[model samples]
Target: MKTANEKKNKMTTSEKTSKYLMPNFGVRDFVVSGGKGSWLFDDKGEKYLDFGAGIAVTCLGHAHPRWAKAVAKQAAEIAHCSNLYMTRQQADLAEKLVEKLGPGKMFFCNSGTEANEALIKAARLYGKKVTGAEGKKFRIVSAIDGFHGRTLGALAATAQEKIQKGFAPILQGFSYAKYNDLKSFEEQMGDDVAAILIEPVQGESGVTPADPKFLKGLKALCKKHGALLLFDEVQCGIGRGGAFLTSQKMGVKPDGVSLAKGLGGGFPIGAVWLAKPVQDIFTPGTHGTTFGGNPLACAAALETLNVIEKEKLCENASKMGERLGRGLEKIAKKYPGKIRLTRGVGLMRAVLFTEQYPNAAVCKKLRENKLILIPAGCNALRFLPPLNVKASEVDKALNIFEKTIERL
Candidate 1:
């Protein structure tokens, strides 16, 4: 008995997504229409506090006026001219990144996966340069739980069996090492190994941070063996770790760094920074991307970095990180056996629940309470709020989290 318009209006967004899109993601019922700073509005006009921040991609929060304005201005001027010709925006962005990351050259891409892939290729080229052979010295050693990307080349670098399950015949010459174990990496390293790739802060695998001493050890080891030390900072860089790069905060210099996510503040962009020693390894025709470092993408990334510095968001992240850490610890104490542990650095944090309460269940309950979170690993939920998040917002989120835990 319903009219056609009414029937159409009654159809939920989840239903449309299920019908039209691939079933790769475990789609939730929440349908986001719009968002403001630290908050998202569902199609029903219900607002939810967004702690996940689009998986740590929205560093400036939703619809930031300055960011939006810069993107609009750039789009009006020029959007995609391809990588055939260079633009001032691209040049300026590259200069800024090189200055921040030390003596390095920058290569732009469209996502973290692409950035990591570029680094892998750079490592291979360096290997061939050093050994004077193509496939002889092209092995890469990565952490057992580290995640590089979904592409075959990147997936081979990633050591998780779950992520690499269906992808057969993954690129060869990749080795695995235990995270935070210097001896394990030493065993994997040899004259044939080109580089060691790892995440300083493993965001996807429960927000575990690499020990400072461990990273320093790897640096020395790489130097001893003429192997490159590459940090996958895709999730922890660009002010997320209370510093521009986690390697900088730890005082360990890596040969190369791959970054994305927060770099564009919700816009799609990625970059790889290679130190001067290996910077010239890539020739003109060796690698290229059509949309990488275009004017519009460079504009977004440049403005994102500018805002972070001007607003002192990195300093804010440090302070708020301390506050959030204390809050999580207190909650952990309140429910003795419920939480196994809480860990992370800066705004990238996680709460590992006991086996009794699964991460998915807790995430669902938090979403039901209008507090969104991202499930990580097997039993942890990540809290990756924006860098500019206020103390009051942190308190509100904590209160909601505590209430949800009590109910469970």
Candidate 2:
């Protein structure tokens, strides 16, 4: 086999990826070699402090020992087995999640979109069974600018029109309610509303956290209207936003929670956690997934949880997130005309720029410097560094961020 430099010179990374992969995602054209902690190394040996963490997926940093061991051990033992027969790893992982959530059950999947898809299904099923609200009454109410996923069911719940465009005749029975506005949500709440789906921190539309008042009030409204409250914790859960369950810190117990991203510490895993009563809604064969709780994924997730517990990533996320936020605020104040707002929780943060300095431009600049980031909404710069991103790394990132903003 030709060496990297020899091969890199012959065929660009972009060439290989574009020729092989689907065009659904915007690939950065960087052939990543490896990562350690908060940084990633390209095949060219260029170092980049990854602030995006693969879009907020690697919470415990990269290539950690725990994860490496879990993957290795599980692979050697049993990489994958169908959900037909019960697997020990699967049972142990489920039991562990049950213990963590307390009086809840778990349905494993492989992506946030799939988790949301399952949650949507369960809510409709509950509506049909419990409330006797069949086809017409099984409507989902989601907040504007909220991103559930790209699957048809979750896509229909997504608020952004650009994503849903051309996918004509979307999944029906979904309604949009104004985010952070209870009056709008109240108006939308009715017998037809089977569930209200929301993100604790809107990761895609910039990291705008849901107000406690809106969350608490949404729960009350759900209860009053006999609708289940679903929290799309895909981006905020598993110590991303300073808590295991961010809604819990606000003292609200949602009936359903969809999680992915960091759940498997970079491995593909998504879970829909259900409250006690809501747990029993799905009987055998009622819902299923092929790769949801396979031994490889379960082992990775089990160890990911352990690493979070042992390393106290939640505490680290809180401290680093505050430091990052404060630094961003200072930058925003210094460049008030360009930097419009900075909003986020823990490591999940976004810096919205004035229309004069577009978010896409800022994102492009960041990527040019080999820094990986993503644009949220139309004018927001999203950042989701690893939970273990150090103070030194944070400081360096701030400098890079400042330089990037100054150029604008």
Candidate 3:
């Protein structure tokens, strides 16, 4: 039997969600009320080490003082206005991103999906420019297992059959190629190809990092075919991959990059950076967003950048990522039959479980042990702790993870 208070709380939360919200996402029963640093607290005051980091969205962790203060201050001053005018926040944020990304222009939007859509549109315009016609060279080649976004344009670029199943007649002119295979991509690189878009570190299918040589080969291929090389760094950018952008660490210079997951820490803000050659594709009337780079969103993103640089969070991500990788490797050794291998760079790491131990089962058991993880593909578990996570926190998470595996 449940108390009246528990019944009332249920009515206000899960029950209400069941009645009102759409049945799209798999809703967790745990009601998260607050978080700090690298931990989350449910409404019942239960603390859990948050290794998922909101699927790599919260790069600075739950609530950083600088980020919160900047958001609050900008919200009080001016939350939003039409893109008809400019704000200091937008100007500063754009300038910072351009500097960090190396000679590019930034377009702001509301989420990663929107950022990819903008990139897709950019590819189309570039294609038109290359072939001197609207649809002459407008095909896009993405990886087979790549997960771009749910929006139609981004979805079309995503080659997953399961994701594209119900949505019939996906946008046309999109093709698939084997990821990290130079020859496979070359087979698809016809004159009709406009862009070769890929995630330098594929996050959803699994945290699979691209081979550096393969990325360089794609850039050469794009140059030869007059097609743009775009990188979808939404999940692996912004210090999460031990660098400002994972592609940068990989030493590949792409024509465009899509970013969003951690761009504003926890706030919703998406951005696309286009290199100088194709920056002029989107003229004044081509594209725009009303709430994309508003004062509050820009402020939050700017403060996130400020904190990452000042605290050397990128270096921290690299250092702690090594520690976490080593720990996972040890665990893999202990359970060699059950665990396959660990993949990914920096904070964007995943452990591949053998069929004997499924990902969903391990994830559920971890949650019960007060540790949060994200499931990827069929048998991979993602561990995306905050970039600024303390060493002690990493050790604690590793302890919990090993113990959980032991019990299993």
lDDT of 2 by residue, 1-408 (tens): 899878767876789788777988876556789999988998889888899899999988899988998899999999888788788877888898788776889999999999999999999998998756578559999989999999899999998898899898999898998999999999988888889999987888878889998899999999998999999999888888887877876678899999899999999999988999889888887899888889899999999998998988889999999999999999999999998888888888888889898787788788777677778885898889998889999988898999987876
Instruction: Identify the superior model by TM-score, candidate 2 or candidate 3.
Output: 3
TM-score of each: 0.97, 0.95, 0.97
1 versus 3: better lDDT goes to? 3
Clash count list over all predictions: 0, 0, 0
> Which candidate order results from sorting by lDDT in descending order?
3, 1, 2
Model 2 quality (TM-score): 0.95
lDDT of 1 by residue, 1-408 (tens): 999889877877877788778988866677789999899999889999999999999999999889999999999999999888879999999999999999979999999999999999999999999999899788999998898888888899889989999878889989999999999999998989899999999888789999999999999988888999999999999999999997799899999999999999999999999999888877999999999999999999999999999999999888898899999999998997889889898999999999999999899999999999999995999999999999999999999999999889
Off by over 4 Å in 1: 1-11
lDDT of each: 0.92, 0.88, 0.93
Better model by lDDT, 1 or 2? 1
Error of 1 at 263 (Å): 0.2
Q: lDDT winner among the candidates?
A: 3
Task: Give the per-residue Cα lDDT of candidate 1 at 221.
Answer: 86
TM-score of candidate 3 to 2 decimals: 0.97
